[model samples]
Target: MIQNGFMTLWKSSIAFFSLLLLGNLTGFAQQSIDVDSLEQVYLQGNFAPADSLELLDLLSVTFQDPQKVIYYSETLIQVAQRQDSTQRLFQGYLQKGNGYARLGNQVDALNNYFEAANYSDESGSDSALGSVYVTIADTYSMNKNNDNARDYYHQGIALLRETDDSLSLSTGLSNAGDFYYGLGQLDSALIYFEEAGPIFEALEFRIGIGYYLGSLGMVYGAQDKPEQALEKLNECLEILEAEGDYYGVAAFLPFISDIYEKQGKYRLAVQYSERSLDIATTYGLKEQIRDANLQLSELYEQLGDPGKSLKYFRQYATYKDSLSNIGLVQQMARLRTNFEVNQKQSEVNLLEKEAEISELRQKRQDAALYVALGIVILAFMLAYGLFRRYKYIQRTRDVIEKEKARSDDLLKNILPEETADELKEYGRVQAKKFESVSVMFADFVGFTHYSEKMSPEDLVKTVDYYFSCFDQAAENHGVEKIKTMGDCYMCAAGLPFPEKDHAIQMVRLACDIIDIVSGDGYSEVTGFEIRIGIHSGPVVAGVVGTKKFAYDIWGDTVNIASRMESGSQAGRINISESTYLLIKDHFECEFRGMVQVKNKGMMKMYFVKRTLQGAEEVLLNKTTETGE
Candidate 1:
């Protein structure tokens, strides 16, 4: 085992060493070709010139190598078309558009960004649309078209509500704020800057927060509050210092110098202005350095140094015009040429391709006709076979419907309508303990004697008649029949759904039973008077079984209720004190105090007096307690 383990370890070590060697060799091969080109541009702070041009040249060269560009663009489009996600499609268009934009193709970039917006709209991806909107807005801003830039900025803000991307929203807000500041709308600029500030703070976007604060400070400076402006601008510097954001520090310093210039502190302004120029030059920010030089020129003039002011002013103008020629206007002209060329070529190619493709399809159509005919015949045979299967399924469905109806009827008989609904929805009913549910147990007095006297047929007939009367009485009183055991009838109120007037319902059910039995329908047959016992207390009721299910009540309340029924006189609804308390006010009930009957130490009872006036009084009897 030790030898085998050693051998395995040696093999693993050899494999790892071989993989490392291969990776190192590949890395070296890549390093040998143009590695320093991108690296030097990034490391030497040459992003404004070389890095931008390199990216543009790379995209232009790769476009003719269609295999290279097509992998990214075509794959993105294919996935976007196949999937239902519009956001993903939007991202694909955004990336493709960015590729075109990098090659100085603004027209294609604009078209693709609009396409992204459409996809994002369909997908409800407001955040993704916000990104595309920001890009379009920034392009317009860079071209100095402030009106179009501000319009797109508001549209992006509207889209930002649907997305929780604080970083992106803050960036867009900061840009819009700066644009407003440049247009001299100081108050509107402050509002945008402040709005963006909190979002950056919440997201912990340190760089974005610093920029918004600096922009806000610039707005305050314009509004003539140098002290307030200085506070915000200094805080901006503190954040940049802490974050070591040299790029941000370069951008913000010139604005801080303006705040000093506004406070009549020309010396301090000149000092800060020189520092801003140093940082901007260090970071290769030529545009920011030009702004700093202009500030310094004004500061020198304020300090009574016209000679130095003129020198710096000349430097500022030279840098400004250089930036305009090489940076903004030149890029715009390149974009215009690319746009016109692509637009004309694409339209011409599309029209030519459509006309040329309409001819070779006629010969192929003649051959496909025979194949289509054969396929139609095969489809008919398959459809007829499916029809026979459908008929057999219909017969099975009829049997299922009948069984379902039978089950529904069984459930309705066993449970209350509401209780049945709850059981179906939740799959089971929770057992509840009712402290004052009225239970009524009725029995045919001398039922055993009557059974002995009558023939079997006559006894069954009499019992059936008695049961039917009991069921009707229970139904009329809104009580549930528990079940009939031999000659005794059991019913309950205040469950399975509880009611405040359960005792009343029970009393009515008991009285109805009595009235029904003594009526002319059964008076000629010589039936025995019924005895009823009512009790109120806590009882646990629940459905218990895996296969054969039934709802049952348990505990001492049930037992005491049965005892009350056994001890009661014929034609009386005898109830306990608990039941009496609930229903006594509603009915003419006579108290039967302290009855000594069963295991219960002692219990108060009541006699329910039958009201003769009207159905209203009898209905009130349903509320009376029969004390036992």
Candidate 2:
């Protein structure tokens, strides 16, 4: 027991001394890597292997525990603050952002990149700005904010172009091309990759060239040019192999495998896919690992190896699921952040509204407090002023109202009252679909001879007197005046408002017009008489045009109505077969068999003689029986 206790005590003593020595050595190492020296060494690009190793060692010593990145960043920030060159400070921030990105702290990385970009922009350093934009784009890309990443890549490319930096431009172009490729815009992807290839080749940037070639090859494959795809992919493989870039080689192999798979070369597909997976696993490329697993899964399934297929498929699904979960987690985080941001914005808006409300309330309170005091002093002046103003306004408004009434009456005279009402309510009225309407056409018989016999003034008076009689008939029969052309008058009924007796009313109006012209009021011409026609059918009526508009009816109905008037005899009311069918039972009509109407072939015309007599006929029959 004593021996075991002594051994324990001795082990503890030795461990304590070893820790003490380690602490002393660490402190000494830290003192050697002073902030000034670090800034100077990094600025001059004089970081040798040993120098980097020493800095890394000193960092370990400074952070003796597994400290948060913020703790380490604080130390770096202090060192950066002591540096005189803005370039060094930007580099410090960029490096810090990259570290945060590696640690999956996207917000911190974004903040650092933002700061770096601001400093670079202010300093007019194109290269620095380009680097900052690239870093920011990478962060956004990691989160699959493709839109933001694409925009930042474009900005970076523009900034790099200003510096004539081929490498930065090539990188930016490659990234943009990759984004386009992912979005399935093969044309855009090809253009950007082609732009990047020349620049990368000029700079002898082997990795950039490989990436561009691979991307171009994929686009070619997507474009269904297999031969071109194989050529490009082979060239990419050659470059990747020569550069000994295992990660790049791994990446290119999968693309080559894709070409083989597309070509139905399953054996080659399996071989290349396995090789890519091995290389990727060795190099710890998670992306290549995932892709290789998926490719193998498809290859195995194609080869009909169910067991192997299932194994690879499981691996693929597992890794894919993990990646998907990670994406979902990141998406959830972003959504939570956005929700918080929205909540804060809402609160800010609410506060602003509250402030406005408070300001209004204060104004109202002040106005109320001074109301009694101001009213007594201002009453007499306001009352007299208001009275005179009111009187002037009242008189002016009365005149305006009278003028407005006159204008309204004029409008009613031009259009039907219902149409005027619609125009006023809707500001502008739409054309109505009138299912059916009554149309009438009237022309004076032998008016030309009558006009020749009279003087010019007398001729005008004679026509006016005739047209006035027709107008009165139209008004009595509830017909809307369509228009009068020379001595011919046309009127329509049932629109802009519809009526059940539209056809009957139109027939009555026609008879009235004929009767009035044939009466003793026809002294201007001894044998003066008017021929009238009426028809009823579907018509479209609408007020057309913005200025100088008129309501017009169009359809077969109106055309037939005009034909009826043209086919009428003097002093006769002619109607088409359709009109005769509707009004024949109500009125006495003589069927003028098969009148040749234009475009109507042979139409049965009727001469509307007069309305039927029921009560008079019954009375006459009873009297005849009684007398007999």
Which candidate gets the maximum lDDT versus the true structure?
2
TM-scores, each model vs. reference: 0.44, 0.40
lDDT by residue (tens digit), candidate 2, 1-628? 1123222222222222111221222232344445545545645768774354345334433332223333444455555566544654565465556455534467887898798787788789897788578667766765668799788878887888888667766766666676666566878877888898898789776656776777778788768888898898888888867755564577667666766777888888789889988987886655456667767866887888876866675565555556457675454444444545698876666677679989999999999879966886699779999999999999999999999999899888778888888887887877777887888889877777877788998777878887887778788768899878888888998887788768877887776676677678746555677888888889887787677866677888888899999999898889887787777656778988988888889888899765436424433653575593
Clashes counted in candidate 1 amount to 7
Model 1: per-residue lDDT, tens digit, 251-364?
Answer: 666656666665666677678779978886776555556666767776787788977876776666666657556565444444434445797875666566556655546656
Error of 2 at 72 (Å): 8.9
Stretches of candidate 1 above 4 Å error? 1-70, 73-85, 90-370, 416-431, 452-469, 472-476, 522-528, 618-628
Can you give the lDDT of residue 94 in candidate 1? 62
Alpha-carbon deviation at 583 in model 1, angstroms: 1.3
